[model samples]
Target: MDYLDNVARNFTKKYPCYLIPNQSEDKIKAFLTDRVKT
Candidate 1:
């Protein structure tokens, strides 16, 4: 969870949109899903 928290923090720094609490969860899930596919 700590690792993911760090990733989320870094990600939000890069993409400010991810800071939206409501959308962040789905966005992060989608991001991880896409990464896994690649």
Candidate 2:
């Protein structure tokens, strides 16, 4: 969970403009999936 927290923190810092007002589970899942792939 801490790893994910750091990842999310860096992601938001790097791409603040990419955020959405209503983030969904599916979107979070997809982001994690994509991150895992790389």
Reference-based TM-score of each model: 0.49, 0.52
Q: lDDT of each prediction vs. the true structure?
A: 0.71, 0.63
> Looking at model 1, which ten-residue stretch has the lowest summed lDDT?
1-10
Where is the poorest 10-residue window by lDDT in model 2?
20-29
User: Candidate 1, 5: how far from true, in Å?
Assistant: 0.6
Candidate 1 residues 10-36, lDDT tens each?
788888877767768557756866786
lDDT (0-100) at residue 11 of candidate 2?
A: 70
Candidate with maximal lDDT = 1
Could you tell me which residue pairs clash in candidate 2?
A: none
lDDT (Cα, tens digit) per residue for candidate 2, span 1-38: 66766766667667666465456333554687688989
Kindly give the number of clashing pairs for every candidate: 0, 0
Off by over 4 Å in 1: 21-38
